[model samples]
Target: MRARAGGIAALVLGAVIWSAAPVSAAPAEGVQRTTIGAAERATALRFWTDARLRSARDLDAPPAASTPPAASAAGGRQAAPGTGEEVRVAPLPAPGAAAAAPALAASDPTPWTGGGLISTTAGKVFFQNAGGGTFACSATVANADNKSLVLTAGHCVVDAGTGEVYRNWVFIPGYANGDRPHGTFTASSLFHLDQYVATAGNANYDLAFARLAPLDGRSLGDTVGAQGIAFNAATGREVHSFGYGGSAAEGNGERLNHCSGVEYPDAGREGSTMWGIDCVQTGGSSGGAFLADFDAGSGGGYLVGDISVSAGSSEYHPVLGNEALDLYRQAGAA
Candidate 1:
């Protein structure tokens, strides 16, 4: 589904151009938070009130023995319960899973096998349009209120250098260097977290979600549709990936799509957002959406995860979990 109010595609576009230079900390003409979540809302008077707030270290850990068993990525690969292995964010999508599949009447697109690569999202906190600059990145149309929503890394939206956010941001789908086929959408909202925004030393969970206004004359999901979001599951038999690497190999256009070999699970990559699977990509590929689809079958593609903030390797994710879901939900709510 396309972002209802102009969602993920815009985020992917912004991230591609982000980090060119630092954006200002201060909000522009309409960058401030006109709306905030329950947590941020309650902070209005809490700072001056009598009770003190707790820091990250102050929170107690859930009892190790009381935690539920975590499913593994491997169909049969087993680990003892509560073993330090990292668990996936949520249960895999199926009829029983809370996650729902997209009503795709169209045959899915095959794994990108073209000569060039597809774009993905790579965000920078202080992104700006100082040079009329445009960045091309990949994004999936995911179901959110039956509308489109873009997903990317938190640092892409929030300023990494300072806690400042970007302003006058827009998403240019299929924006290759300067080739903008889908045109652009003004960003209405950017969703992230205080932890990533601060770039804390041990920050691991670095997901982000953003919203954008609809295109001038068309609707998103109605026109472009969207991919299904996968959660926790052991059913990943094989997956396909895409990206627009700045290498001479990717050629010079956005329409050209380059793809990777079949993806296999890397045990060490578990839990870290920067997880990597062997793939042929480099710097410009960060934030590209990792899609799930059948390369040789009738129904071909759906976006289940995204390329996390790592270079030279692949770390994609299907959006899920309580904490992460809450954060993303709050992003749309805000």
Candidate 2:
């Protein structure tokens, strides 16, 4: 995918330029957190009207380098076994929410008709880049101790080079067109690995977590359920990835689309390790969940990784290792 001017590309470019300055080696272990205060949260919620969402541009994915980096090891410490469990809750109805439609069979980018937890757990993320342009990406509600954490790509939340978190970040769960069935939740804080900040959005640490503020006195998890998350899990498993990516045939990021395929290890520029799958999801799909062991009946699965980069018909996910585990732990506790 080619990087565009207004969305994630600008952030990545900023990070790249910043990394050129004299600096120490990227941190071996550390979590960086950006808190959004109550005032900012309120402003975010008010800023994203239905009109703005419909007009928001897709957050473009960064260009994938053809040559893999020279580093051989995964960037962080070895990952432990998978952890966290799926937390399913009853779906809440939103006024004017779109009715559930049948999902299409397995395809590279097909409509998600499995009307279950995923219909509520997976949603669209909207925010403003440093340039003040509104952009949209995908996100998932992860089962966290706080019941408010959502997972997305790191680039969606922060500009690695400048260490600046995007403004007016909010998530629309079960979003279809302009309908927000579960209401909108503003981001209370953003969390990611320090390595991502130091390395200018390294693919190895492209994942991020956003702690959300409750909407109408209801927490996001209680409102729409949350998916299980796993780290250091085995690769090569058949995975289902969901996103609201825009394409000429894909409803232009207005609807949920999915791809099912087996994942394999792939190397990214700067030695960043990632998981690659055969998928055609394009821009605006960044930060969507890549689930393993997805059950069609329940629409639930373990979140093994997230959409980070796209090259041709393949999409890449960050390998959730020790650094990602620590970031999740911190976000859960926040």
lDDT of 2 by residue, 1-334 (tens): 2222233353242322322211222222587777778888878888998889988888766543322232223444422222453333222232233444444445578878767778888999999866667888999999888889888998888776677677788999888978987788998888877666665556667789999999889888888888888777777988989988888667789888888887876643444467778776877888998988777756777888888887556788887776677778888888
Count residue pairs with overlapping backbones in model 1: 28
Top candidate by TM-score: 2
The local distance difference test score of each candidate is 0.37, 0.74
Clash number by candidate, in order? 28, 3
Across 1-334, the per-residue lDDT of candidate 1 in tens digits comes to: 1111112222222233434332332133212232223342233223322121111011110111111123232333322212122233221121111222222221122224321112222111112322333233344444455253666554344444345454444444444444444545445566555434332311243445656556655544344444444443233445555544443545422332334344554344333332234454433343456655522332224444554433223333323334445554554454
Off by over 4 Å in 1: 1-136, 198-203, 252-256, 261-275, 294-302, 311-319, 331-334
